[model samples]
Target: MGVFKLPWSLLKDINKVMRNFWWGQVEEERKIHWVSWKTMGKLKTAGGMGFRESHSFNLAMLAKQGWKLLHHPQALASLVLKAKYFPHSEFFQAKLGSKPSFIWRSIMDARELVKRGTRWRVGNGEAIKIWEDKWVPKLPYAKIMSPVRVLSPEAFVSILIDPGTKQWKTSMVEDLFLPEEATLIKQIPISFNNSPDKLIWSGCMAPVLKETSKMFLPKPTIKNLIKELEDSGGKELVEEFAVVARRDAAVDRIQCKIGIGLIIRDWNGRVVATSRKFRPLFPDPLLAEAMGAIEASCFGLQLGIKRIILEGDSKIVISAINNREENWSAMGMLIEDVKIKLNSYEEWSASHVRREGNQAAHKLARDALLHSISSVDMGIISHCIHDCN
Candidate 1:
């Protein structure tokens, strides 16, 4: 399959034998074939058991050989193929000459599939075409959506990058692309080392097929999930000394600080303790939310509370805190601290809530930003929240 494309007749015969065996149709005794082979070939997460189609799988394997040719141009097979088939151009740009080898034809047949499944990761961006290449991963097609106007058709992606800083030229990008596209482009992290641009597999390819399969399914909203948790004997659990720690962060633009508010409630929903803290502003709100979570955990520890149900309005921060995967973002250290802090407790959990659901902590955070009041007693905290609201 890697060296040559399988004939359609052979692929069909192979699939027929497999289907007959699966449906217990041996010796001409037919059985019910409940599902179509095409449907069965879909990924498991997409409502089908993951089964490989021989013909498509064969092409994918051939495409892998073509990919190898792209990355290993100096290999023996690559050298021979390049010199004979495409002496003047690369594999991707190579066309079918008067006569071509079977292996070359097989690989070329899968070129479009390979191209559709891959994108370019920008670095110096000199080799990447701004309009033609798939470089922006955040976009639907991984290509620029804005209509071409000021820039010529042949413009390279390097024109949008700053040479000295090795960072995106923000103003130039904003001017050239749509507002949303520009925002996404800026979010794509630039390498400080200024590495060369390289071709990469896009998420639509088989490499990420498993992870992305769940993306097609519908998800319950945070509010519904939180309400369901509370109704499903969470009251009984809370009464068993499971403290609810509600935390929020309010950004103070004038002072350039994040005002963190924490409210710990006991079994009866009465406040056990209250805390207010201030930290320097972070580039993203997720960082500020993560800091607030750390503070919540510390507040519980200081009071010697063992079990906790930490709640926050920031879904991203809550998700990050609960995720087992290693975070490598700008606020990765802060998220790591939050995870460590939460784990210190004998029993702990993080839950996301809508802003309206976390009114008390939100009020406290706003009060911390509006007034100079730092901390308040548990009794006074309720009144403060009401007054602020």
Candidate 2:
């Protein structure tokens, strides 16, 4: 599978058989399935059993070949592929020639996924074009947004940095970019310290390879499955009662104290529930933030809320939860525990909000400390709701 792409029909048939075996059904015997194969293939953290889907797995395997062709130019397979299909052009720029080989076609088919995962890491920046290549971390597969006529096609990323000082040429950047684009450009780190421009997978530290199975799994396709269920008389499964909730934490370092607060609200901004709790100590703000999320999620569960959009002021914690990255800090274990707790919900999302947007929760957290209270309910936090308005 790594060397050649599997036929889609063959893969589909195999998955069908696997699904039957999974549910203990024989060729002659028909049986009811508790869950669809599509749902079962979702990530465990997303309420799925983490089963591998055949078509996606095959595409992922083929993508490894594409990755090698892009990043490992010296490999024998890459050399041969280039010699046969793209001798006059780079892998990305190569055109599909007349009657391409099956293997070459398979490899080319996987390029989209590879392109989505990888981005240019600028070093001396000679190899990266400012208007053509993707170097911005925030915007993947996107060039700087500006009129093409304003910038020369040949302009390299190096032109935006001061060669002598190894710093951004701020004046040049400001002149070339709109105010917002200038700010985004400054956020992209340029260094004379590392190797020349290279491609890197966005999620991981290294370039993607065949062994990185996680990269190939299709993003949760639960939406499609939900639609299918709805069409098949499972309409209740597609319905969600969503509510928005904001959470915040306050830590008094000198007193070794921690306070967590959350407010759940309807779309009209009317508060449905509010809670605050005091903890003995939290080593850092991140842990306190994670605890606040856990508390909010648990509180929602107790209220029989099935769908929640959990908001927090901690960008670091919210990003970790949304990305599903393994946290390695002192709060790593606690964050993992919070992630596990979140899996119980039928639908949930963790997002970051600016401090000003989470004022109600922030004030409630501080109130927990002022009142020396271990816990406070919705009735006690009425003033917090008024403050939000």
Using TM-score, give the best candidate's number: 1
Q: 99-217 in candidate 2: lDDT tens per residue?
A: 99888888888888888777776666788998888876555354687765556887898888777876678888888876756756654444424336677665553211233323211
Error of 1 at 164 (Å): 1.5
lDDT of 1 by residue, 6-81 (tens): 9999999988888787778466686788999899889999987788889999999999998888777899999999
| Candidate 2: C-alpha lDDT | 0.71
**After superposing candidate 1, which stretches have Cα over 4 Å from the reference?**
204-389
Clashing pairs in 1: none
Best by lDDT: 1
- After superposing all C-alphas onto the true structure, candidate 1 shows an RMSD in angstroms of 12.6
TM-score for all models, in order of appearance: 0.55, 0.52
